[model samples]
Target: MTDFRSRCIAPEPLAGLFCAIPHPTGVEICAATGPDFLCLDGEHAPIDRERAEEMIRAAQLHRVPVIMRVPGHLPDSIAGALDSGADGVLVPRVSTADEARAAVAATRYPPVGVRGVGPGRAAGFGYRIPDYLATANSRILLAIQAETPGALENIEEISTVEGVDVIFIGPGDLGVTLGALGPEGRPKLMAAITRITKVSRAAGKAVGMFCASPDEVQGWRELGITFFLIGNDARHLADAAGAAVARAREGF
Candidate 1:
């Protein structure tokens, strides 16, 4: 009923998946399937601004929230995503407190943040945000990613960066950083995820992680990780496509 990314920021903890591969149809399909949010992949997936805007529009039209995971952790990139009307911005590989601070500052306007305020898609394409300055910071959700070894080592500090709404651990990269990406929930990796949840909760921010399966979600939830990204659109489609072909071959 409520779709963020276009109107409100961090209105709720968006429950959803990231679509690394951008096909409008796939974006539309994810919307119909009904994840609370959909993150447009620009960092790992090849995509353009035009396409990202379209997907954001699509997701909003279908009542699914959209977050854009930008390629860089730079302020300009973050401001652009915010201006593009992203419900939130998931910054990748932010291992330090400064990077986290910069991401927040760039998304909010002066007095709260140094973001340059002007009219754009974020402002209803030049017709919105009548009170953009007064309310933007309260609405914008800032997510800083922890996927590197340095990030894991400094989880407490990273989690405490002011204005950060959530701290998400990149599972694959996180495990690889810890040198154990083979299984889903290795003891060490699970502990790392737990640490993030604990630190973020103590700092008054939400903690989140993306897992390969729903089975993996419950445990993370028990660990106080509320924002659980189940999986991605491309991965699910690919797996289903392969399985369907295999079944047809078997019938043959």
Candidate 2:
């Protein structure tokens, strides 16, 4: 029987991968490599229901928490990810409090949230001695990505969403909206991130994001960021692979 996860460190980095690679072994291999946490792309990646389960199992074995990023806010997909055993979930493009609440509801079961409860792999089935429900709500890291001009405008409202444990800054998408990343020294994007973090901390929620380097992380950390995700699987692999290829070609 596996131990129930009472809590997991939220993933984060200044700039990290969103892991597009398919296959459980690939996920497993990436997990073993250790790069903050893996945001399993249940949304864009070619992973089906069965493979999601396989990947979760492997993540558990490696003792690395996996955040399942659902394709959208669809109820069924959200329900499936939680039931399948992801440590937490990252709902993308969440621009409203209602959508954020819906995502939180999908991950929990009654009282705390609205997820259906059942003895399954995530709970170690009936084998799990300690009740999985004992602290599931606090254990589940509910995060919503604030990635658009709409979300930034509603940053305070979105940050106040109930059951939303963390607010992540999707700066890339937000950056384009405010025009080229360099202009105004990213004041617009910076303001959005700061607003979300400010409101979240005031409301007693965690703040996190996808940081590219340690400097970005340090900046966010100073801003009270906690459950951040550093990078993804595919980027790590691509970076390493590219360097290897470059080194090999250098002889030519």
**Candidate 2 residue-wise lDDT, 2-120, digit = tens:** 22233332323223235667777777787677644567888778887788888888776777777788889987787677667787788889888888888988888788667777766
Model 2 deviation from the true structure expressed as Cα RMSD, one decimal place = 3.5
Per-residue lDDT of model 1, residues 117-152, tens digit only: 778797877677776656677777777788888887
Quick one: best TM-score, which candidate? 1
TM-score of each: 0.90, 0.83
Candidate lDDT (C-alpha), each? 0.78, 0.72
Q: Cα RMSD to native, each candidate?
A: 2.8, 3.5
| Over 4 Å off, model 1 | 1-14, 183-185
Judged by whole-model lDDT over C-alpha atoms, candidate 1 comes out at 0.78
Error of 1 at 60 (Å): 0.8
Cα lDDT for residue 56, candidate 2: 81
| Superposed model 2: Cα runs more than 4 Å off | 1-17, 124-130, 179-185, 213-215
Name the lDDT value of residue 103 in candidate 2. Answer: 90
